[model samples]
Target chain A: MSTAAATHDDHHDHHHAPTGLKRWLFSTNHKDIGTLYLWFSFAMFLAGGFMAMVIRAELLEPGMQFVDPEFFNQMTTVHGLIMVFGAVMPATVGLANWMIPLMIGAPDMALPRMNNWSFWILPFAFAILIGSVIMSAFGDGNPSAPNFGWTFYAPLSTKYGPDSTDLFILSVHMMGISSIMGAINVVVTVFNMRAPGMTLMKMPLFVWTWLITAFLLIAVIPVLAGAVTMMLTDRHFGTSFFDAAGGGDPVLFQHVFWFFGHPEVYIMILPSFGIVSAIIPAFARKPLFGYASMVYATASIALLSFVVWAHHMFTVGMPLAGTLFFMYMTMLISVPTGVKVFNWVATMWRGSMSFELPMKWAIAFVVLFTCGGLSGLMLAITPVDFQYHDTYFVVAHFHYVLVTGAIFSIFAAAYYWLPKWSGVMPNKTLGELHFWNSLISANLLFFPMHFVGLAGMPRRYADYALQFADYNFWISIGGFWFGLSQLLFLAVAVLCAMKKGEKAAAKPWDGAEGLEWEVPSPAPFHTYDTPPVVK
Target chain B: MSEKQLSVEERNKRTLKKLLIWAVAMFGFAFLMVPFYNVICDITGLNGKTSSTAATDVPEQVVADRTVTVEFITQKGDGISGEFTSETKRVKVHPGEITLVHFYASNPTSTDMITQSIPSVTPGEAARYLHKTQCFCFDQQTLAAGERKDMPMIFYLDPEIPRHINQFTLSYTIFDVTERVAGKNNSVAVN
Candidate 1:
């Protein structure tokens, strides 16, 4: 594996990987850690989905039927927290770990040991969080998990909160640390580790999006840490950072939290934007439409995210000036987001389009995510938000974005790259079944939520009024169907891992063009030991 | 090959150092928000976290003959039922003239209780203009069981307060912070 004085072909041998449990415990390999993060995220997804099941089951008949009201509150809180931090974020990082270096022609991440540390810290961090949730539920009078919502509003979270709030705060702190460390590694790698010919513009859209997303992470994650730290001190250390009774304004907490939070929404979706950009062009059998504009659009969206934090607080009675400013700035996000969507559509206009599984998911991503985006634009109107705030409309909007947009892209990425990574092609019928089931049921699950919300059904409630009954029942059915449909994807992934399908070629997708595709199927344990010459 | 490995190691160390520094600095900057808010508010007046000083910034005091009425409203806390009343329901004072008011607090609880009052002015327009040089809200009031205490607040409405705000209500919510500052002596640690 030595590289000095070689003609850049030193990666001819298969390196023997360490066997058994120790391999995962200490392995710094990008592929291994990527797989671990993906699996861990899938498990979290299931956990969050199970919580959703409880929520939907409770909502089925308009009154409390299954769980107690306090437990219902816990389910909502943990569902949002786990899905955001555990499922979506970790899965994105997993893809980045496996694909970023491969796309950029680097042998590995710039900081491999730190990468392992980043991955390892997450399971324990989430353990503390979920443990607190369980303790609150069953600790024989111990306070249940922090139930003031994932935002953990002041006073409700600080003054009246259970002792488990401390655990939630500390767990969030660890999650923030992991995110920052992962971000820094991505930044340094993208900046200093690219192959000689792969200039910033020439790099894949995935790399470009990750570069921006990583910078956003570094800038905002610390603020989130600071916020939770202040919450910790306010709860225990006699600090009145958010205490209204002690001269501190509770509104101040909202200001600081959203400052980090608004950017975080982009941190999750920007990479999906990148993946969509990649998939649309590849399956269209054409060069990307307006690649440079796509890059600029991503950058502008990131920049605009900072100023629009107040849109989330429109219902908090912000000053008219602040409301208008945030309203317009939030509306401004639609422009760049529009350009990205238009670019994807334009890329597929009059080209050799294929409806393969990955493309199917990508196409669904564009349409359904646009549905989410348009609803988001509706939410951006400050006056309109007054009616929609704290309602299922907001819930519907984000699920459309996160589930149909981000999670769909994750599945698309898996299908697009599964052949290359496993050296085995998945069953197409199963893949399509997975896609259609997820797509249709996800809409049924989320779309009716908009109606119930508009009809004044409040969110996070264990029971609903009689008028909201029919939609809730249908939404629950959709929820069950969507939950069951995920098994198809799981089975397909398992079969691919077991080499139960056809042997994949070196370049499985003919239109795929990248340094990754240049490598043989089931990319060797040590790829490009001598970095490939990317032209 | 070993030399190449050494160079990679050195580069990673450099990046790690830079990143660690940035994380620390951001953390520091977050805590700095306490002071930063004050400094920025001083310039922009965006937040009304008014601080009282010995004297007003204006050299000329334009005391007006026109009177403005101020009403006092009190909110009592749980386990802190008390007879909290002002010396009078209303005070009419000329702008920029010092006005003195008295508040009476009685602790009906069997155990000694510590209480804090949070103040806000209605119509909110003259909240910042109504500055109290000495208010019971500036310190926690501890009363023994069945003990009644008289408290005084001395303040002046700034002459520059817009005349449209002719009347304002000064309301305070008395919170039983008996548990918060229970162990601390000298509870008047003003921020």
Candidate 2:
């Protein structure tokens, strides 16, 4: 290992790296590509977040206040699309690019050039998506952006969707290409480039989770591409794949979309599980409890994801047997999910634990993510889902999982690896401020949604009845507060990247493990060009 | 598994090739889901897609001991501004007994409109058992402007329809397809 680092430093000096914007534009280096992906996802996050602000502002009162219903729908649609595809997915991929090679003691991703292509495709894909949104607002009498919720259920998407939907279809196709290529790169890297002694069982949980997540991506992204492509033909080519008039069923759209979509959700979170698994053990100063079980649970969750997609469409007039089957299958996800939550807590049980900035976010993720999971279980009941379907309760459930669960884990990983990535520790005081403000405001933002949703408030509406006004007002306040709190995170990231903090040792966290810590802090421009023997 | 002797570059290439093939297969699989969905629905009688043609499998001896109520309902699908109503709202008959119902549709619009009626049976499991011997839903119906037409459907419930099911609803949704039909006609004329 020591010899590996020594050679890494010499290699860094002699690599003759490309400089300036050219370095990023045509970069094949894993760390540089990882940086590009992270920054792109963050920018998307803010753009999507701005849309959230618009939505919250509009919903701040009962009637339309700022934007019309069409624009409001566009905001909600694009915000969801951006956050899921543009923000969370890319960020996880970025982490994979930066850390997988280091963790597995490999030189780089299997396909370095393809890695560049995957990361590069995302910006253009989002440009088309967001461009459509803009064109909808200003284009010559074209229909407003894909106002059909993120689900873009058929008939609405195929029959009545505006011209922007065509753009949406194209953008989705590009994004699918990017994701599939990225996933292929991951699968190839993990399978081919692991250090000789680093057995599959010995790989870190982050790498293992990512391995599973990549498979899920490969399997489902194409299905999504299929769904959108069908929409494309149905809209322009008049194929009627989803039109009942031509012997097609609208329910088929739900079937296909959720088939991709259910696993797609697991894709967003499995990486988070990996992140939290890494962080919790480090902070608690203990090995993760039930390591083998965690892997099995993740696999089972992924497997179960395929069967439970029908749960999302329970209200779509499925037969009684179908309903019960989906309901039970959806509930079965809880077993694996519960195993993960239990393992995280059990790892912390009676262990010497420290609440660093990263630990704080990890702890929040577990608690809030469990809240999201429990609500998901509630929604899994076919009889009850009829009451909660399409309601704000569903909205609240996902936000708790996504914002607190996935986004929080992203923050945790950022803080945990900031030193390793940037060569400088994030400022302690600023980190604390960011953590506390986000946790509280985020709760304030999402917790009340459950009550409001239960009290008969539907989601995706520009306005609501007067009875829900007070809750809406406070929720908007929390939204703004939570939105502003992320600025502290930005400042911390920028400052750390600028090297404006205390210098970090190779192993900044006392309990941290893996070859990532074996290298110097900031991880060098390149390391492990010659893979280290894992043992 | 046996690639131990191969170089890293070769193994990586092999793996990448396999994954690319898998991705293409899954993409093809997604499209395959359409036909696969139909096959499954046909088998399970799910999604309520009734058979379009006449049924020849009805039992000679009716299930006289068992009688089920069949309710008729009509609704408009998207883009259908035409008026439709079921003449016979409800009927009770023994399984395997032939039953006939009439539905009326009127084109009030100034333009001649072509329409198709899609039939669905409720308690979806009952769909396969409800055989339509003759139905307007079997083909597109062209109604001239200000014309009203009475469409009759002949059907019979299968003798083996689940013993627990005593009643079911046969619903038809009418969709206006004037433009689609016209477009096909124009393309044919051009050819």
On DockQ, the candidate that comes out on top is 2
Write candidate 1's Cα lDDT for B1-191 as tens digits: 45345555466677778878887787777667756654654443344434434334432464666888888887775556888888878988888788789988998778998888777666544666776777888778898999999989888888887778789888777888887776445343224
DockQ of 1: 0.35
Mind giving the per-residue lDDT tens digits that candidate 1 earns over A26-130? 878888888888989998999888889988999989777988888888889889999999999999999999899899888788888889999999999999989
Off by over 4 Å in 2: A1-15, A138-142, B109-111, B185-191
RMSD to the true structure for each prediction, in A, is 3.5, 2.8
C-alpha lDDT score of every prediction, in listed order = 0.84, 0.90
Question: What is candidate 1's CAPRI-style docking category based on DockQ?
Answer: acceptable
Candidate 1 residue B159 C-alpha distance from true site, Å: 4.1
Candidate 1 global TM-score: 0.91
Model 2: lDDT to the true structure: 0.90
Query: How many Å off is the CA of A534 in candidate 2?
Result: 2.0
Give the per-residue lDDT digits (tens) of candidate 2, residues A396-439.
99999999999999999999999999999999999999999999
